[model samples]
Target chain A: MTSQFPSTDDVILGPGDDAAVVAAPDGRTVATTDLLVEGRHFRREWSTARDVGHRAVAQNYADVVAMGARPTGLLIGFAAPADLPLAWAEEFTAGVREECALAGGAVVGGDMVGSDTLTIAVTALGDLEGRAPVRRDGARAGDVVAYTGHLGLSAAGLALLERGVDGPADCLSEHRRPSPPYAAGPEAAVLGATAMLDISDGLVQDLGHICRASGVRVDLESDALRPEPALLEAVRVLGAPAGNAVAAARRLMAVGGEDHALAAVFPPETGLPEHWHAVGVVAEAPRGSEEVPEHPVTLDGDVVERGGWDHFRRE
Target chain B: MTSQFPSTDDVILGPGDDAAVVAAPDGRTVATTDLLVEGRHFRREWSTARDVGHRAVAQNYADVVAMGARPTGLLIGFAAPADLPLAWAEEFTAGVREECALAGGAVVGGDMVGSDTLTIAVTALGDLEGRAPVRRDGARAGDVVAYTGHLGLSAAGLALLERGVDGPADCLSEHRRPSPPYAAGPEAAVLGATAMLDISDGLVQDLGHICRASGVRVDLESDALRPEPALLEAVRVLGAPAGNAVAAARRLMAVGGEDHALAAVFPPETGLPEHWHAVGVVAEAPRGSEEVPEHPVTLDGDVVERGGWDHFRRE
Candidate 1:
């Protein structure tokens, strides 16, 4: 069943057992782990316990889905000081359940421990339905690159929060709790995606991972990278100068991370899914090109330097 | 292949990929998580990082094996201060690998993050090989209970450590790195175990879990629970009074924790496994008795108080 609506719960075993059992009829499991530290990954001043919980589950589930699998079960390792309020933990658990519901995943088990710092370590599992995983190394020359999901909203939201300014609610909210494009993952896999990845470390940087792994170069079509109306509205409302909205959007798409968007490569002739927009094309090494091109990712015909979040980040 | 020595590697994917894939030929997965904190679970002054790593994996792997599953994969979420020495991490990793080899598990994936306090959260997965899990609730009134592996050594070693005294090599080493009865789990399952558990919180306390879950009372034969020579040696070396050494070992068997031994309930007609020693018998409540008995666990017809490890431990 699709996560767009409710589906049957997939728990084979819940908490209170020595361990949890999850059904894996495909004879394989797609698993990923994500660790979030309080001050480094989220700040209590900026996000609620519920928001932190949702963010943690969303990112790890996105990774499983990106591998062309259906997210099924989640196990959490949560730690906080003895003084942490019970209400905070309850809210955090509620958020974890909420996201698991949306992702069609079961909260099967977890480990709770006491520590000086608040920490969350999550392990997510997914079923692949007997399909070959859409690995990052599967992209080929002449493949077309497309991405589905919001691009600039999260970056703009972070900017608004740092400046203490008001922008579109969607903008600020995206930064607080990421809503990854869950359905796009399996949909791309079904459509014969050649390669896939979840964009957590920004678009260009993550796509570079696809490029280096597949030994190909990807060139973005600048015309297709236009800013959506909401992003432009946020840029203008945040007091950006006239004519800078487009550049702001470009930077957000290029370097701002944590949107948890889904990006995939498909054979050029394969019909693109309705929600996927073709924004780039993969290229082979030129006649004399080396094993790995120095610049494997580009905007139009120019190269983009990889930089830290400071390039477009507010914090 | 058995983990008594080397066998085939089980890795399907390492940490380099966005997510890891693992074989689940049994069409089901047994998963468990354990979170260990710095001071609450281990102290760096007392444990090398390698010891901490082994302790962490041993406990989690034991849980899976307790459910009649074969350990297959491990995922670690490690967090520590920015200034922690790199050598600590390497040694910790080596310890993880060593234990995984002994338990027949692969380090499939992990998340490394930075936090103020050192925290290691682990998720271990196991394959059941199409066998039904030996749940704690499956025991019948006439079942027999048996256990294999060292029981009181860990508690006795902890006692010696607290007093800055030395004990037998195996005694102190058991406290440092738990050597769980890995093979006894599946071996018990094949021998038709009805209920099973890992003894992490001392023998009587853990067996009480099975008694409560299965709605039957267990009576341990005091003859089988006599202190072993090494435990007595530990008590004597820790400077216990002559006659008190036996009392000390008996206390360790009753209340010491973290020995990670396998305890299982078997049908009355089943022959006990090679290394297993029959130590107890399951008893149904008398006619018209309440659902659960007031005292579900007894030693030699006498009710034994379930006390904290502090009763026999120094820390």
Candidate 2:
């Protein structure tokens, strides 16, 4: 699609200049950035250039939505080997354009450089429409913790792709391109979310951020999760330990990242969306607490291990 | 120094959420980004983490200043091997903070990720107090071209470092940390510059950008350059070709990138600062000519080969 604003008109000053000036509607702007490396973030064999671009935009946009903001524009930096096909670059831009459309934003500008491997760094800008920013430090004791997006779906999809599971093609696709519940973040804020975060890491890990920031503890009820049954099928297909499967799903719900799900703690009285589930409640930390509980999710009436991905350690 | 605003107060929302909201003065923001890779941009053996941080901030902030904007904040993304030292990260942050202070800005937020090699991506934000952004396309025929900031110094230092020629340690240090004429950008803008650009990609190459964009041609009188005598000393020490010294200097002026100098074409009658010199004049492209001149700058009354760095074929 053509740019929403003419190249000359949309940008008060275009890309060749030092900095770009974009129209800020509400006198406030929201900004976030993410970097994607070639082999580490994506392998050409597993993902097309378009897939890479889509994933990049989706993840960053997820962050904006999680803040209850609407994405406005994006600036991308791409580094690639000299030998890479020019077509790949064109396709990548197209993917960025498509994802920006999905996220209600535009690809305003970017820089391209030569590298031995391909890397993409993306910065997203957003608008809050004068609403107070919802932060992770505001969850209080007695708040209801709710999640508005897929829980273990991305993790399950990743497992299926890794183990070569054959049941559902869509699961593998989801692993490549996550469909975050973008609208849910702002909706949660509008509904009085006290604290919020994007579940890019894992459900538990991200909620843990809210817990630590807000100085509260979180308790999750496994039965309340809607995606458990679907995840179990993949667990069974992989013939993995049932405990590991449950832990993976729980950890993802609790720690699995990259889904870009928006999890928030709101006043207990606040109503939640149809897809959102009240998996837990925020409470004051217990006295003499030495460690945060890993498996806060109770399965079959017992707590289990919730091991999720960690950037510095093997998953 | 502690943050100017409390984490909760200044950030409105700290980093845990999807995006961040910082107060934008007068509802206008200046944004620019740059990516620096480990080997491509700098070698660990040649510079410390702190030096890398300073260089990264300097180049990006130069862009902001090049636009006649006052930098206010920066967001950095770092990708490094998992085993990298924590102290190195801290030092890097300190360098960024130091340079931000120099530019009158703060390090607002950033992201860290694990990668096979180190890469630092910086996005700088600035505020222009109601001044129009100076662009490269604004020059017209008969505009006088002038430069503020050091030229050929970094290139001279690079030649010494590349050839392993020992010199006063300051030359190498200058190469590692260029002191851009930060205030000159807006100064030129306020002085009624017709068009302006940062002299990062060598004098001739950068001016070429202005010429190509402004639909004009540039003619440079090299005898007017002030640093020629000093550069000749470094050239002699490096044992570069004797007949090629002038050509080399012109090439360095033409295509040399990364000096971060400010170059602008001003109205012919405009007075310039004492340090600023009349390097060239912009003129209409010659009739029936599809190609620009082979050498945009005439060195000592002769045309010379102007070659500068291109990432794809720099070496």
Candidate 3:
């Protein structure tokens, strides 16, 4: 009201009370949030402001898709240094708008604050169109675990970048920007997936979430992983320790995060699309097992000793 | 899901999707978000981690109330250095929990990441039951402007602290932690407030927002403001620049922000609570005015310039 901006009737109570009532015409709403920090979550040297913005929106929207919801709107809170370039901010906003459009959503409102470093926080809202949310705790003992979208590629690319290895541009591109299988989440839900999640943090770690939530053990077959060859080739080219690379790739496929691929557990006999590969199966925990009740799937017939990324532990 | 956490049915879809869906039994949800950055927003020396947590929740929740909604839940995204004490993090969460209880909400979810400095982002959700939102774009000519909650105390306290003027403990408390009139927001909405907003930036600037949005001009009668001898005494003690304490009070009541006071425009004949004071009137722009419109109300028998905090141009 301080400026000459035209007021809209839709904002019944704009900037005044306990909550802004956005008209949810469909009667159901979906909500997800993501936070991006300087250095830790992103590096200005590695990614441009636009790239950071796109990455931020893509990851959060992937979560919305994982929930089987159609993203509708987003609210952003941006914190940055007072001296930051105004153009950076503008381009960042443009990136968000572009990514939101890709995810079929609009940026509704945002707050900007001056901080010492750049940080972007985004909360996305969606509409379910009346479908029940598919949860991670619904996988049964006999469910077949399948995945949609690329795996190991992000981890392989990350390894290549970290080791300063030059590779085909594809590897670096994969590390810089991830293309999540956005539509596959709701599609899986409609396909009768009992339980599903987005593969961020690596396959093993993410699937461990489903297993622990569903109280089941999982057995993975290594032969089914087709991306291993490409990953191995990248690992060989990097000349870095192949132990961690092989282990990390398989581990990331099992345990690494940020790729944001869709993974779901469906009935054993459920038909899957070509993009989805049968990677594992759920099983009852062995009686009186000394290990954790939910067992992790093994790679190349070897049981993975570690779980996914733990914030408390240094990588 | 990786940790030993309880599974709740309330979290229909947790942590995997672009957005999470929760039950909204009332068919309406209230929402607001805020960003608090280190150095710019708060100095660690001036506030403890717990204080930061409390302030973050307090200010955002106040916005929710300003919308006339009941706080229900909150999701927080915290970015801090890895070396930040575990105890500090615990205490910070405790503070969030304490404020949530005070505002009648729960800390439903959050994201934590490592950053060079601490930053907190909070998104609060509320339920409106079934009431219309009171907006700032409804004030009409001849409407009486009133305010609930303390005004200028924060600015006064801040000025004292900035000048290193030793004051009574309560003055520092006001500067450190503001107690916004949370209930007044919904109360004003129910009372049929034509235009309303929380006085966050400053009374004058915020009112200017309402005026611009509602297409009206506001004029404050200086004599209507009560005596502020305490502020005068403090200003004198600090050897601050000379200004009418009453005029400053009037200006603060008009422009200064961060007090989070609720100001509402009502029909001139409407009855107000004992604590509420009628300070101004809403009217059309003055006649024969090229810049400002006709019908501008005379403040203290003269026109007063509008001023307040602007983040981009902060002093």
| Best lDDT among the predictions, by candidate number | 1
> How do these models rank on TM-score, best leading?
1, 2, 3
Error of 1 at B284 (Å): 1.6
The Cα error of candidate 1 at residue A31, in Å, is: 0.8
Task: Return the TM-score for candidate 1, rounded to 2 decimals.
Answer: 0.94
Residues A30-122 of candidate 2: C-alpha lDDT, one tens digit per residue: 888888987787778777888787899999888888888877767777777889998888777778877776778766666677677577888
TM-score of candidate 2 to 2 decimals: 0.87
Worst 10 residues of 2 chain A by lDDT: A1-10
Off by over 4 Å in 2: A1-11, A228-232, A240-252, A287-304, A308-315, B1-17, B83-87, B168-170, B228-232, B240-251, B287-304, B308-315
Residue pairs with backbone overlap in model 1: none
Largest DockQ belongs to which candidate?
A: 1
Q: What residue runs in model 1 are displaced by over 4 Å at the alpha carbon?
A: A1-9, A237-239, A286-290, A306-315, B1-10, B286-290, B308-315
Q: What's the i-RMS of each model?
A: 0.7, 1.6, 2.6
> What tens-digit string does per-residue lDDT give for candidate 3 at B68-103?
676665667888888888888776776676666677
- What are the per-residue Cα lDDT tens digits for candidate 1 across B1-315? 012223234445555667888888888889899899898988887789889879989999999999999998888888989998988888888788789888988878888888999999899998888898888888888889888888888887777777777679788889889999998888888889999999998888888888788888888886787677998888777666777777767777866788899889999999886788888899986542257677778888888886533554434
Model 1 chain B worst lDDT window (10 residues): B1-10
lDDT-better candidate, 1 vs 2? 1
Q: How accurate is candidate 2 locally (lDDT)?
A: 0.71
